[model samples]
Target: MKKLTKFKRIVTRIIVLTLVLSCAGGVMPSTFTPNAAELYSDKEKYISYNEETEMYEYSFYDAYVYDIDATPGQIMLDIIPSTGSNYYNYYYHKKILITWHSYNGENAAQYDYENQKLAESIQPESRINIKFAAKNKYDDLSYKDGYLGWESHKDFYVSQIISIRNSDEHIYGDINDDGIIDSFDVVTYQKYITDNLQYKLDETQFLNADIDLDTEITNEDCRQVIDFTLGSSKGFNGATNIGSIRIDNTVSQAMSLGVKNDIDFATAEIKFGVDVLKKCYDPEKNNTENILISPLSISSALAMTANGADGDTYEEMEKTLGNGLTLEQINEYMAYFISHLPDKDKEKVYLADSVWFKNDPTLKIYYEFLEKNRKFYNAEIYKSQFDETIIKDVNNWVNKNTKGKIPRLIDSFNIRSNTAMMLLNTLYFESEWQEPYIDTIDGTFTDLNGQKHLIKEMHSEEYQYFDLGNADAFKKPYLNGDYSFVGILPHEDVTFNEYVANLDGKELADGLREYADPETIRLCVMIPKFKYNYQKSLKDILTKIGMEKAFDPDNADFSNINDLSVEGALPLYIDDVLHKTKIEVTEKGTKASAATAVIMGMGAAPPEEKKTIVINLDRPFIYMIVDKNNVPLFIGAATQLSEN
Candidate 1:
């Protein structure tokens, strides 16, 4: 009897030990938990290699980013991987860093967003490699374009930096990433203290030096402007002219076909610059010997780089749309659209890599869709000269794209001579806020004159909110992927302009996502749905809103262009800028469309928007178009919106 009892006790002990070793190991000792550093000691253990993008992806939260301000147009991320997302021994990847490039309104590269001149000139590097599958392979709301049957596995990441080139022989100068011209960048400026530096800056370095992002080289007067760099942040900070600008102006120009007969201008052309990029700086790298750079990449810091612009991967765009596209379609279209083109031509064309057509080969059909709906758009149809009926088809597409806001586009398109080779000029958009705002109450708010008015305000809840502590207000951004509507409400005491002027020193910060971050505010929110059309000379507004250097003709240098002769170096200029937009909402979603036509010298136009509330737009409120860096491209306040 004693021996049998002892045997039972031994069996129970064995079973307990087995349970402790299992995955759901219940109640392990506290000492077993690893410290942050200990767990991170072998960073590679946390991540896995993405066969598709050829990049090592880190699965851990807040992975290592060696320098947010690396080369001129890049941010070096020191990714140390760990088990995350799918780590039951297998690795699960999450987010990654990206770059975006800024647009050269007139000259390609000359100064920073604050209009500060670049101390030196460096050429931009080409080859923006971004993959969407890496960002949203597991999410449900991604979108794709074209006939490639929307890619199902295009997890995309952002590439948000832009780098351009310099035409002159000046050295590149930019030492810090504060976006300010400060003394810390003395070495950068010192290199260019004289134009005759022995070693000619590689095309890559010169590309990153062009801030203001115009292609002009610097002279002592512009480059060495005595006080310019005193405290300026010279690196790009990821801001472009509303990546939607080209699209906005395209439809506007076509609809308001009223020509500017009063001001006789010599040239009006907008160039497409996908392949025309040069290397951006990696301040953190600072390897003058073999300066490493990736050009045509989205600018991680340049204020002019847009999310939709180059630099970022089409994969990222697809991932944002959630589930409309597939990976094969995206790859096929990218291969086909960019199939045969010169470096210059490639630099001038860009397409949504993720969006695939039903019949992959008939891409021009998009233009035809617009052409058929011309009257509503009031746009002209430009016929294509490429495939058999590209001209007529493109014209119809212009109309369809605009959804009646623009009419008569592509009226004189030549697929080969006009549409195919020309810079794109058209736009189409339709999106509603995920969380709609309805004006259910008449709330009192103050305007500029210290006058209080009983205004009907729109109210709703958002996935996130940004605290405008500087403006004494709260900002709620409603996003439908790329298309979005942001409504800001200032504290009743402050005026719109007063709020804006004070915002100069403050950072323009916003954080929106499915999950809240530390900086996010979980506030009960209210948003007003107010629609108003704004008309301004695109060029004039660019200058008024802080990007003054680009319009400086003599200081502009854009010789990287194949057509633009480099007799020595050529000064640059912008000929025309146009914009048009429309917004509508219904039970389904918001339908917003816009176009921007920027004619660089005498080039082509490119075109590429949200939704509603129950509130009437009667009282005044502030509105602005700003870059990611907080540089306001355009700012205004609407006093009233006639319901008529």
Candidate 2:
């Protein structure tokens, strides 16, 4: 008996070793054996591998054990069939048995010894034994004290158990689970369909190779897959296999309130604004009429609009506004420029932006576009019902932001039924002059048409940044030194149109910064107390630039903006851009506000050498409100004045 016990222990160790090594080598693992006596039958069973059938045949045994009525403990027999072996690593299918037994013996050591012996005989069937203790007297076993002392009670029984195994299946479309379906999959699928090579596939592979998702793979599916490989079509359907790009939205920060110290990278945007401003100048408009535009405001709203554009639509918009800078560069510079626009004490300049879209279920706008606008432009987003109420909502937003200066932006019924979204920017500025002047005295102001009108001009003599040459210019600072008002009086030799025609944004901004150095001498400054409003549709002007494709509904591509898969979806394109501005220059200060709406379907140096300069605005002259970075907040030609 002692020798048999030692042999059982050695055999159990060998089975454990085999299981551990087999699991690591992609082979069937061995099972454990229990040691309790009378738990398993000693009748020997044998299993042999059939090479011809690639299956394991096992010796059958009596399906039933004794149906002995026990006080508590009960034992039974069970067998199950196996069926999984795809191409990848897996376990072989076979029958397995589990036994539940309890010993009611005073010698616990003897119980273990007898079970170990019973375990050795059942090795051929791959049996595993697990022994556990009952938590309470009413649990698995019941105890009773024998005359010899305390003894374990056998009250355990086997219950119904389901054997489930890991699934062996291939990934759909990506047959090899490589995350992409390329030429390799196409070739394999073609070979399988042609039957040139005997290829076997499970249900998963069948679903994967069915390109059209029609439950079967036909020759047309093969041709479509080939086209997808060649990039002629996106995928089996109208979708692309690649996932959409994602934008991170976890970042948060307080908006800055001062101008950017450096304006080096801002040249591209500033230059573009200047170029657009020059192009907006019309030679045929009334000579007495004034033209005011906030290029920065317009560009900002459009920059936000560009977030949803893709392909040619994006490229043209970028090229029109970049002036050589990439989209990333433009976004960085504009975000910095707008967020840090010198809104210090007594300088009430507000640059606000908003985006409004219809809350339609069919239009699935990309979160990335929305996130980009929010992060870069501090854009306020709203989803409305594209009804008549949207007009009031938009106008209310504009009016509230502009402090009522802009009463209404969207007309009573200008919003078309198909309008998907609208992007808006508003700039409000009200600053007291650094050197307050009395009311303008009655003076003679000549218009560009050579017509002279009696005007009330404000007068002051203070140390100012002044330059005199081909064109006389001066910079008068407002409340804070962070902002200044620039006046450019075209020389009598050239018209205001001719002068601006030769100017570009970089040179204009550079000149504003370079020529604004304070002079030792104080020069007499006289400027008219004027108030005027300019409003116009910028569709033709924007088209004149290289952005004509954005207005072409047939050619524009705003796939990145909203989902194009909806039935009856109209192409997103820009209908028009409406801009309105009002400026009031008085003895106390200058109050100006401008709103620019980039309505989309879905869319310098100079310097120097001047000490004391004298300039009289007795004729037509150009002016601009510039920030510390020389950004033109408002650029206009003051041609007429009110007598009151």
Candidate 3:
């Protein structure tokens, strides 16, 4: 119960200011919309070249669709991507479902290609189609509806990239008008499940009975739907109403957002370190640093994996805990370690919505961390295939943990002969600065050249500024409430690479809060509007950054693992680390999206920068994500138009 520090207050104020500004940006994220006319109109062109046979080995439309739940003989991909002349490629055409998830949940999908029935309970294990769900962000398959194919045979070397339609803009199923998801108008949903009955309803009119989310049509379901339409309780059940996205209202106002995740630290390190901190600095309070600790969510993924049976899942894991142990006690044991070292300066995007299902974003580490602390005998490190089945469990775990708010983060994992493994990480934060900037009257921003960028300044009169003279990096800290918007704007004359190579200054980070000016200037700033994408495997970057020690098979030491015979069973290699970032600041406020996907065999995308002495956020520029210490976390360059 610590009082909010000045830094915490500032961050919170800034977040609220930025959200307000984001609302003012007049831009809304795009959603899914489908067109029947377009689906029937054009056929994608075919491109093919043969390298081995020295002639065209194969050619076809690279397009694909995803009707992930559709059953065999059901209305799978209606107009599957047309195959080329070889005729042999037809096998690749049909609604080929990727074989993934060993689904055992309540709504577990079943495919009876033999009886050609879908609504029936999945036999002990029946044959199925290819898996359509993407387990990790690194999965590159451009999959959709039922048809998934490669643009060129060379791309076949990589996983497919699922082409999910933006929102209602999905590739299929736009049959209803209620703005709610109805299955009737969908293409891949070919059947409806009822009590021991399966009905073939392919049109929008049949969607009235889809209540249980089993893609079904029942008289009882229709009655309930109609009752709600007429505002009557006869058919209305409010359970569905509760299953919506909820963002966290409390964005961290504190300097570090007080996020305490219990990771691989042994108990020897958890002994209260407050006494250790008191000796370092002199302050009014007994301790100089204020700390926050957040409890880790239940590890649903590993719970299911302990004995591998639902009836035995929780029971099996609990057996490891003493008979007297309650779920509550297990959680308390997991709260031991806090990030002792200061949190890196990360301007991370916070998800404000409350997690509903509360199980969707379950990280393996989240569960592993809990198990390590649980003191249960069953809580030992175990080897897993990291396959699609495991990936689905991971998704469900995350979905349940987030409480149904995070969407599109865990699509589905595919299990193919060539498919290897996946690692997924999801983070959420929301906080404002402690100090609110003064809402000024027509606050104008001026660039170094004295050019007025016509910036829609956040009308804040009260702001902290830096008087660092000619360096032009720190002039005015964009104050949104207590939070400060500082930029590592690169020199206009230098290429992004040169700027990064030359940027090794240690004291530059604190310059924003400490050495900056405290004046009200009519700052005329012009920031850009853009989203950038880059694709480069990370083996090169990590090696160059001297973190190669983490992945060296000969030297890698993951001895913390509780159950391994050897210290390092799994090779710690990063197949890819993609950094993606986007930034925009205006009078309305700021909205940015950035991420450094640490993919073992997978990933994408974030760090943003502002580079305009002229301050016109236009054209190309490179940016790096840094901790408050300004240590380069990830580097990125945004060129509106990509050449490489």
Candidate 3 TM-score to native? 0.35
Model 1, 66: alpha-carbon shift in Å? 54
Which wins on TM-score, candidate 1 or candidate 3? 3
Q: Pairs clashing in candidate 2?
A: 35-114, 35-115, 35-116, 36-115, 73-155, 258-340, 440-457, 440-458, 507-604, 573-601
Which 10 residues in a row give candidate 2 its minimum summed lDDT? 81-90
Tens-digit lDDT track of model 3 for 1-644: 24555555455445433433443454321222344333333221112223432222111132223223434433223113422210113234333332223222232343223223332322211111222222222222322232344443322211111222211121112224223422222211222221222333332334333442223344445444333333344332231322222222222121121223221111111111111111211233322121111001112111212211123223433433212343334333322211222222222333111111122222123334323322321121222445444444444433332223221232233332322222332222222223222121222333332333332223222233333332234322222222234434555565433443443322233343353333334334333322222222334543443334333434433222112332322322233333222333322233333222333321111001322223333333333332232322223333332110
lDDT of each: 0.30, 0.60, 0.28
Q: Give each model a TM-score.
A: 0.31, 0.57, 0.35
Model 2 Cα shift for residue 192 (angstroms) = 89
Q: Model 1, 575: alpha-carbon shift in Å? A: 0.8
Q: Write model 1 residue lDDT over 391-494, tens digit each, in one string.
A: 34433343444443433223232222221122233333343344443113555644334455554455554443444553323333334232233344555576
What residue runs in model 3 are displaced by over 4 Å at the alpha carbon? 1-385, 395-425, 429-462, 465-471, 474-482, 491-497, 505-507, 510-515, 520-522, 529-537, 562-614, 621-637, 641-644
Once fitted onto the true fold, the runs of candidate 1 whose alpha carbons sit more than 4 angstroms away are 1-398, 408-427, 435-457, 472-485, 504-506, 510-522, 543-556, 562-572, 585-589, 602-619, 623-637, 642-644
How far does residue 27 in candidate 1 sit from its true spot (Å)?
A: 93
Question: What's model 3's lDDT at 541?
Answer: 40
